[model samples]
Target: MMTNTQTSSSTERIAAEAPLIERLRAGDDGAFAELVSTHTGRMLVVARRVTGSEADAEDAVQEAFISAFKNIEQFDGRSTLGTWLHRIVVNAALMKRRRKRSRPETSIEQLLPQFDDGFHREKPQSIEVVTNGGGGSIVEREAVMAALDELPDEFREVIVLRDVEGLDSKSAAESLGISDSLVRQRLHRGRQALMKLLERRMKGIES
Candidate 1:
């Protein structure tokens, strides 16, 4: 929960950004530079989590910045600049991911949880999906990340956008050019696969 002071500070920050948004709309080069310098790190974090490749992430950020600059005029104050850019970055990263030759979706089925006649074959352990900079030891975090990369593109993209990037299902669906129901389905299965992979990875590390 946000305190009153935090709420007030947030309101003030948004108000302060009004002028910068206006300048950006007016084609102020300085404002554009300022926006890039200030928000590039945030955008890069989202891009990296989505693409899982430094080169791809860098390319996505570049594409996102270009899209942001070109579409600044359409940005209403309904959403914060950060929120807007976050969506742009997700879209850019998803596009880059699509351009790559992807593995078969069938490969991910083997990674998901197994069940028998509407019941688990074995009781599964609860495993948390750790997003970038989320709580966990460095080793656990790295293992979780590696597990994420091992997921097939179909499931991995949804998990990264919904869980890692913190986008809602509808937004993630739009970014992925899929339906909201598909986003939900993929996220559910993606999390299961991620946990199972992480469990094996941790066991390997322990041994």
Candidate 2:
């Protein structure tokens, strides 16, 4: 949830950017370049999380900028310009994923926690804590990213939008063209799968 101060800051930032928005809408090349320079790195991070390829992520960000320029008139002032660009890049990345060679979907049931007759997890001890006691190092971060990359597209996208991109359930649902309930379901299952994956990776390292 956004605090009142955060909300006010965003509003002020948007107001400050009114001139740039006008210039962008007017097809000013300099304004467009400035926009790309200002936001490309962050946008690429969003794209990379969803697409999981540097080349694909870059392509998606480029496509998003083009789309944003062409549709500048559609940008209402309700959100900050950066937020608007973030959504565009996410959509572009998802579209790129759809166009690529599809991978077989992994069974979420395989990743989900299994229960016995008494409704207790069959291997409860197998579930390891996600966080390292020490602040996590780069290797741990890479391992977590690898685990995320292994998730099926549906699960990965939901987690990236909700957890990685920090979108609310409503916002994530709106971005993905799904219902809020579906977003919640996917987020729950995706998180479970991620935890399981991380646990396996940690165990592998210990062995």
Candidate 3:
């Protein structure tokens, strides 16, 4: 049986769609609540990937929601509502990155400490295959997450949108405010960096 919370959440989501579509056209209250509930989770993930910090991600999501609410009427409804919202979230995240980069802070290169060991880079073996073969332990998974965190913001955003969020290259590019070629370029570089990180970790296990 569905719990009261589940029922309420489901009902709210369902009720949101039609009302949201209408209210967005006319600019009404339901538009805001509807969008917030529907897109917040995915938007947060997008923001987190771009900003690489939980607090910054939360702020970016909030700003994105506010911007979307204000500009709802401009939405053409050609794409899924989620896609529009994802674009807004990406814009917000990129703005946050701009602000941070503009501030006087430690340069990313300066922040990195030298490593004493060498590691090889290779094509990434599939995580699913390795895990199913009982090759990945909890520590391995943590290392992968850590490597993702180390990626440059541009590389990280494309990776999250494409691989993690399952967005196509065109959609991901639209969301990131970049061209398809740039999206492909970023994804390629991002994958290479991730593969290098993973290979380094795997080498640790072998040694």
Q: List TM-scores for all candidates, in order.
A: 0.77, 0.85, 0.68
For residues 82-189, what per-residue lDDT tens digits would candidate 1 score against the true structure? 767877898898789778747644376777777899798888654443332344588776886888878887898888878776678877786777999999999998
Q: Which scores greater on TM-score, model 1 or model 2?
A: 2
Q: What's the lDDT for residue 166 in model 1? A: 68
Q: What is the C-alpha RMSD of each candidate to the true structure, in Å?
A: 5.2, 3.5, 8.2
lDDT of 2 at 170: 80
Report lDDT (Cα) of residue 85, candidate 2. 87
Give the distance in Å from residue 21's predicted Cα in candidate 1 to where it truly belongs. 1.7
Q: Sorted on TM-score, highest at the top, how do the candidates line up?
A: 2, 1, 3
Instruction: Please report the TM-score between candidate 2 and the true structure.
Output: 0.85
Cα distance off (Å), candidate 1, residue 87: 1.0
What local distance difference test score does each model get? Answer: 0.79, 0.82, 0.70
Ranking by lDDT: 2, 1, 3
Overall local distance difference test of candidate 1: 0.79
Clashing pairs in 3: none
Write model 2 residue lDDT over 139-176, tens digit each, in one string.
Answer: 67787788887788888899998887778888788778
